[model samples]
Target: MSLLRRWFDPIRSRWFFQKPTRQEVLPTEQGLSIYLRLDDVYSYLAVQQLPQLEEILTDDLKPLKVVISDTAAEPPNGMTKTEWHTYCLNDAKILATQHRFSYDEEKPEQPTQEALKQAETILKNTPLTGQNFLYLLEDVFHMLWQQQYGKLRTLFVMASQHQKPQETPERVFDHTPVLASYFEFGGRKYHAVDDLLRLTRRLKQQKLLTDNPIFLINHIEWREHLMSDAEELAEIQAMHPELDLYIALEDPISWLLLAYIKEELADYYNIQMNLYPLSYRSRDHFDWSLATRLSKRAEVEFTPFCRPTADSILEMAHLFYSVPDDEQVDAMYEILKAVWTKGKDFSFKSHFQQMQQLLSIEQLTDVNVAELLARNDALCDQKHQPDFPVLELRINGKHYVFNSLYRVWMIESIFSNVLEQLYKSENDAENNEFEISKE
Candidate 1:
């Protein structure tokens, strides 16, 4: 391990980072502080689950609603506005179907001020517990997102009577621009279904759950179910499909994902892989360090503390772009591994020489490294993306943008169908059915 890795490994491996003990009591407040925006699709889905979540926790569940700034919500760490919008809608559809929540793709009215006013009225008059507050929240969210204007008019009239007080409720709007629904409990923050599942597990461990059966309706399975049999692999490998991967050298998540692709999916299927080195300025809104830590938590093989400088990132990108088309993927893989796994400084001449040796090349003479960097930068600009490691798999002329490794299964599922169709058409033999194993 490098000095950086050695120093940070123990810190990152702290007890808090590990799975919580059954006896471990959370060290913060007793209730759940949900940060929400009425316009956010994720918020709507999360709110729908609150009734169930509250039923499980009972008195322990003190759900405080904090309305966030909707207009200020930006695309996730490395997504374009268009891409983000598409992803949100698609993800919402899948989640809504799974959770049996109603969702519409059409743009909903901005109900932040109205919802806040109503929430304030409820908090001032009614006790912030039981089904009343939950019902109010559900109604407000449904009215705004689902356009279920059933009792909203009566609720609005009742809310309007309560003078929109000079001092709003203690849990008034905190104007943070959040992209998704998240909960803060005992100093720890939980976002979306996955994080909420973790919180649920912790609560269960603490014996916080009443006799009610806890339903983690939104929990998503992370593992990708792929063919393990030799015959199945051979059959799939016959039909070659293309996987276009867009990566940013500076991103820790990209590094981890690249490593995962190389180790797991590289030879698993007969896919023509096209690697694109994406270049873009880092966003002021995102915390790269936090993302790095999160990536490490997701994949323990990831370097916990290593971060390459801007010049180093550019130099690495130049080397990546300068390589031959066939050698580019391997070259990029090695460069990422050096900085992210091996913790080698990209600025050093020795590291560059090592990378060159790994690439089995004397020097990159075919392309000007500086010019290649400029070209990649321009391509990144043209894409108009704000995030890193955006993977767009084009199958049958249709493009799907998958954000995380968890969604790799969805890609594989689609690939299975595509491969089966191609195989059947070629063979014209219904006798040999290509079974896409879910396990």
Candidate 2:
């Protein structure tokens, strides 16, 4: 780890998360406050869930407030506004499908500026605090996502802006919207479904959740269900899905992901995972603090005993390549655990010897560590994403590169989609054959 990271990681992990935003530390009194804006797909998805959220919160946390931001955030770097908008729509569709939420599977029309103005006019006119806000907002989201512009236009015209509503809670949500939509409770923000579940779990700990067993829907169905028999497993294997998992020795998330993929995914599927060790800048998506939070959530042990040096990383890289492809998974796990958890610094000769003995590895005479790393780096360079734990998924004759460890779930999703396509194509062939026979 670099000197900056060494100092910064701990502080970020410790202080940054603990400090609440300037918003009201008033989960008890302020209830649940949601912030959203038009033309944001996640805002639409989040609005769908609020009616359920409003039902479950205690009387103290009743009345969900919707704070409409004037504008959506700029697209992430490297993407045009159109590209970002398209990506968000597609991404939101996936989330909608995953959560079984109400959504149009086809590309929905963007809300016209006039429609946005009308919706905003209705929302701002509606009481800024109460369940009524969520109901009206839900109607707006449904109309927007379902492409019911005519109904939205009628509602906009008929809806009463004449009812003046109190806006005392506006003082609490002063910050601009960064992501699509999020809930502010007790001065902290909880994002769409995943983080919303986290918030409810926190409430459950306080014995504040209703008797309703409000649990997050598990979106990723493990292959154990999809592959019912040897025949199905064979068919899935025929799809030729390949995962190129890139990890960094210094990154804690890389260690977490190696174990996750090996245990959660690799064991069940015939997919080949080509491991590479090329790391770049950390994306805002998953900082060390978030990784550590997920660590506790996953019940995985994550403790850094020593920061790796450049010399140590090179030595470890050579050691990594020395292991055969089949045994590399186990070897990688041991190497990471040793340096990260067991304090076996590979830079020291004694520690290096211990690890070599552990993996039963001999420094191969033909292995060129520098050449191998360069090759991997060059192959990975094709993916324009600059982040650690980069997953290059090649499946069903298509290539998809995801830049975060948070998205390991996509592997299973792709497999499911591919399986559906295979089944559909096979049925079509069988029908064609029968039609030819009949003729």
Candidate 3:
């Protein structure tokens, strides 16, 4: 990241998230509003929390405004639209099971287009506003997600045939996925799922809550169930799913994540990991402030650091590839700590020499740093809307990719999936053995 980009990105985001759409009804200064879509899995999860959110907001001044967005952003994670929706459905199911959200386990994993169409029609016609809209919207989400097409149609017909909506809810949707369904409060935007914890903190900061309330969202925590079953995870590790991580050496979030993988995950899970280093930040898709917040949740130390000069990044990139395969993890982790945690400026001759000697790097001759970064770029390009510190997992011809900066706890979630597969395979094998003995 350039020195200028370090400052400009946040400023640009602040302006972008708060800027009104062309047709947006201007919000009252203190109004709490959200934009939701009928098809978004997370939007369904957000609706489940409204009663709790309302309780938390009881002492506050305004009812939450609901925007029924009509469009969606491109699917993330290099997935086709169908693939992204499928992942969201499965992910939300896990979230529901873990957090006790209302979900119909027997319902289809992905809602059919017919189901979504009924929801859109009903939501478009429902006679409600403020908390009344909140009341009906939950039922709408419930019926749609639970595959209650018959009940949804009844609701839709009842809504369309006899209802008199005093005002129609406007359709204003942005292509940005985060904006597709999010809360706007105190001039800041919060993604309804990942940023739920952050939103609560902001509320407390503004004195909306005098202290921590009885209501808390625990989904952001590392799945405690996954952590409890170390023996199962150890068994699954033998399957050898590979975690390919791409990092931009100068980015602080990369350092923090590297520490978490080493400090928090290394002992508990055994999987082959390959690390690739880049001399530059993955600019466009990167989320900056959110990355810092994620670091806090991961419980890794992070400190603000000067953006490394171009020269320093080049030197470090070359040193990383020069290291033996067995030594790469330690070499990369040390580099991350010195620059990110200690604010060491490897651009300085003294600092550069010290880093080289500390990591036991030998003198370089004809080092091709550009080619190394190009290789990183090629791997990173394999992702859709790729960002620095990308984490990709490959197992049994299936890929699970997590944007580590957005959801640090997702790594745990990934392992949970792995364990589930391993257990099922083991059970099937045992059944086969028993059948053979009987034969």
Which candidate number maximizes lDDT? 2
Query: Model 2 over residues 1-439: C-alpha lDDT tens digits?
Result: 4556555554554464454422222356666677777777788888777777777777776555657676667665355677667767766676777667787887666778877777765665555455666677788888876878898877666555455434656423334745568877776777765577667766666666676645447544322344457776677777667788877676777887777677656656767778887533233243445566666555566654355666677778877888888877788888988865555556668778898889998664357776777777776655544346778888778877766554567777777777888889999999999999999
What's the residue-level lDDT of 37 in candidate 2? 72
Q: Across residues 62-101, which tens digit of lDDT does each residue of candidate 3 receive?
A: 5666676657887654568766666576666766765677
The better-scoring model by lDDT among 1 and 3 is 3
Which candidate do you rate higher for lDDT, 2 or 3? 2
Instruction: Give the alpha carbon lDDT tens digit for every residue of 186-301 in model 1.
Output: 77777865467667766776777775444554333433444566776676667565777777666667777777666667677766677876553452233443454546544536
Clashing pairs in 2: none
| Candidate order, TM-score descending | 2, 3, 1
In angstroms, what RMSD does candidate 2 have relative to the true structure? 5.4
lDDT of 1 at 119: 44
Q: For residue 232, what is the lDDT in candidate 2?
A: 65
Provide the lDDT at 432 for model 2: 100
Residue 415 in candidate 3, Cα distance off native in Å: 3.2
Q: Which stretches of candidate 2 lie over 4 Å from their true place?
A: 1-30, 71-83, 108-112, 127-129, 158-175, 186-188, 213-218, 221-231, 238-240, 280-300, 305-318, 321-330, 344-388, 403-405, 435-439
